[model samples]
Target: MNDITVFPTIDDIMAAHQRIQPFIHRTPILTSEAINQIAGCEIYFKCENFQKVGAFKARGAANAVMKLTEEQKVNGVATHSSGNHAAALARAASVAGIKSYIVMPSNAPEIKKKAVAGYGGEIIECEPTLIARETTLKEVVARTGAVFIPPYDYLDVIEGQATCALEMWEEGIPFDTVMAPVGGGGLLSGTALTSKYISPKTNVIAGEPEGADDASRSFKAKELIPMVGPKTIADGLLTSLGKINFEIIMEYVDDILTVSEAEIIEAMRLVYERMKIIIEPSCAVPLAALLKNKERFKGQKVGIILSGGNVDLGKLPF
Candidate 1:
């Protein structure tokens, strides 16, 4: 891989912040004194759940679409996602007055599908597998000549994701540790890079579900270990980490903590009950890790990214 793809600079992130500011929501950072007392840590939640398209994926998608060349924009954009990013890219493309082709899993939630279509995305369903998703996306790109805005691996997307952390640094109080869930590792990689660049003393932590713990294994082994048939309630987190994300993670991430299915559910429930906000299972993983290992965060200031609120209430896990 090229150096530019592997190492995204702070300037790239700052540029993305400016580029996407007009298109995406500047989601607020929230804190709960009640929950802080329980966890024994002062916790700040960057509420990306309130972001456009109900996920932090909006930041990356908006940046990617906005950065497209005029010629490329005319041909439109395409991407494959099980959920959030599909809707996000669709929304970004629509806002930019271009078409969006979204290849989604056949088994993706109805709510997500509706969001993609509602934002004017043309949907093509594929089997719920990495190979199938990639194959189907190739077909869509070939047929439409659309620029493929990958969900995580692309440099522009990573830089856009980093803007979330940059905002945390600019808006919130100082934090000793910043945590986010690891799916394809987009958010985690961006968080790690931003933390290292802006707050060198801050440690970046990743929270991954036990059923999809390839990231944890890869971090420990210092190699990429892809996940196969990961069965977790956090549907958004089933994908393996990307190569660029892995590179950034290896250099900047402090540690990865894995949580069980029950712990994830408990965390989700606790956040809803105490914080009075909705978060998808994937968003709850980081808090689950903190709850499981409270001693590590005791007396420390921590930041957690609530990645999305795009949950299908009809198919509730609890």
Candidate 2:
């Protein structure tokens, strides 16, 4: 739609890097020689789990919020997110010294809800559905006239998400494939754009959980396959890709793969045990895909984006 909304090109992503550098953390790349030797692939991990708000969503949120016009800033901002985006927007709003209204699914994790409030944003609980989230956001926007900062539907946000890839490219290491978990496809779209331009030879892959492979379907069908709602172990990847992201992903992404709940759980345990890093199920999907498709990456350098570390131990099914 609308020529795929050419968002944050490599230049734009680099600018986002500069714009958010003062605010965001350049999360470390965690590596495990042990796993590498066993898996037969050199892996470089962009641990966005170490990022502020515990996810790369903060990068996009912060950039979009900061770009608001003075008038728009004065009116405030609003958004709908299940978790990471909510925390990110709330944090970004606080940094920008503006009021933020976050509408979240009623069933969203309590920890995520609390993060939104902790960042000084007002929260409104909606039905556990995107329709409700959008309805509430529209009402808030119409009433307060706040700028609506979309989660993954906006260009600025996409560019900011791509910055993670831009930063990863700094090592001058060429990857055979760059794999990122897909939810709303914000991260995948950004990663694909960055990889295509920065490392033209690299294949960009989008990882999704089985029973929730909307992006895969969309890519293969070459049309937007909107999932009203999806069920998946990776909560972060429960939504279908956005229209803009679908276009980019369909055209540029090499493949959209799926992993099972068992694979994700094992991946999570592996990361926690071997890498000594905590990651949510959503963040583990990419790694799970890599583990499952080892044959494809055996001799190539692969980059995986561990999207976030925001997991509640008590709620986990151990």
lDDT of each: 0.92, 0.87
Worst 10 residues of 2 by lDDT: 1-10
| Candidate 2 lDDT score at position 124 | 87
**Model 1: which ten-residue window has the lowest total lDDT?**
1-10
Output the TM-score of candidate 2.
Answer: 0.96
Poorly placed runs, candidate 2 (over 4 Å): 1-4
- What lDDT would candidate 1 get against the real structure? 0.92
Number of backbone clashes in candidate 2? 0
Q: Candidate 1 has what TM-score?
A: 0.96
**Poorly placed runs, candidate 1 (over 4 Å):** 1-6
Model 2, 70-163: lDDT tens per residue?
A: 9989988998887799899999989889999999889988888888999998998899866898899899999999999888978888888999
Error of 1 at 264 (Å): 1.0
TM agreement with the true structure for every prediction: 0.96, 0.96
How high is the lDDT of residue 258 in model 1?
Answer: 98
**Count of steric clashes across candidates, in order:** 0, 0
True lDDT of residue 296, candidate 1: 93
